[model samples]
Target: MPDIYRALGDSTRRRILSMLKQGNKTQKEIVDAFDISQPAIKKHLTILLEERMISERLNGKYRIYSLNLSILQTAYQEMLHYIGELLDEQLISLKNYVEKGEFRDEDD
Candidate 1:
């Protein structure tokens, strides 16, 4: 799932995934939607494909890519774990601050 996360870490790749989430698209179709070159889009697609986040199929002369939802569950679980840990730490700090009366009420 590291690969999936890494691939998605880029803004461009994330945008591509957002588009894919709407529906399947050919590499050409994906490129046409943006001002970037076809090769650039293909590179992003390659990363997503390598990470198993998307799958491609050959149709005639066109290669179509579709989102793979299977890996999403694992990725989501990993992200959830990290977020939970962060929240836990922050909550503990907030509790300690409250106990010390370090925070002032909004009214003054």
Candidate 2:
């Protein structure tokens, strides 16, 4: 599986994903939304494609891109599970610390 985290690390890539979520768009349309050059937008689109977060098809002379909902949903669930695991670990640590009486009273 592609590293969805790496693909999502950039703001431009996130914005491109958001745009596709609304509906499919051509490369020109996507580039027009940002002030950056077409080459920069192309780079972002390539990352999204590599991560399988979006799909691209040749629509005549233009390439149309659409959000890959299933892949994105799977990534979202994985992220949630990962975050839950971290929270659980922190809670367990807090519980152990409290049980050990490591924290002193403010008056003390």
Candidate 3:
């Protein structure tokens, strides 16, 4: 999870992941899509690969990258769980405040 957050922290890497989500793309295709140098793109790809956000395979001499849907799905689920916990905490606080009669009408 920490790895996921780290990988997603970079805008370049995020764009790389987004591009891969459309479909598998060759290293050249990815490099061409970005304005940065090939080496720069390669570095971003490396981080994404390390985080398991994307997978790569050799198609002949070219390296093709694709999104790892399972990992993204896991990340999505984890985010939902964290959000639910936060909402639950807020709701409990609200309930307690209401029960304590913290809110009062001006006429009261």
| Per-residue lDDT of 8 in model 1 | 78
Write the residue-wise lDDT of candidate 3 on 1-108 in tens digits.
537788889998988888887899999999999899999999999888888888999989999999998988898898789889999999999999999999998998
Query: What is the Cα root-mean-square deviation between model 3 and the actual structure?
Result: 1.7
Which of the predicted structures, 2 or 3, would earn the higher lDDT when compared with the native?
2
Top lDDT prediction, candidate number: 2
How does each model score on TM-score?
A: 0.78, 0.94, 0.87
List where candidate 3 sits over 4 angstroms from the true fold.
none
Query: What tens-digit string does per-residue lDDT give for candidate 2 at 16-86?
Result: 98999899999999999999999999999999999999999997899999999899989999999889999
Clash list (residue pairs), candidate 2: none
Off by over 4 Å in 2: none
Sort order, lDDT high to low: 2, 3, 1
> In terms of TM-score, how similar is model 3 to the real structure?
0.87
Candidate RMSDs in Å, in order, are 2.7, 1.1, 1.7
Q: Top TM-score: which candidate number?
A: 2
TM-score, cand. 2 vs. native: 0.94
- The lDDT for every candidate, in the order shown, is 0.87, 0.94, 0.90
Evaluation by lDDT, superior candidate among 1 and 3:
3
Query: Residue 53 error for model 3, in Å?
Result: 0.6
Model 1, residue 82: distance off in Å is 1.0
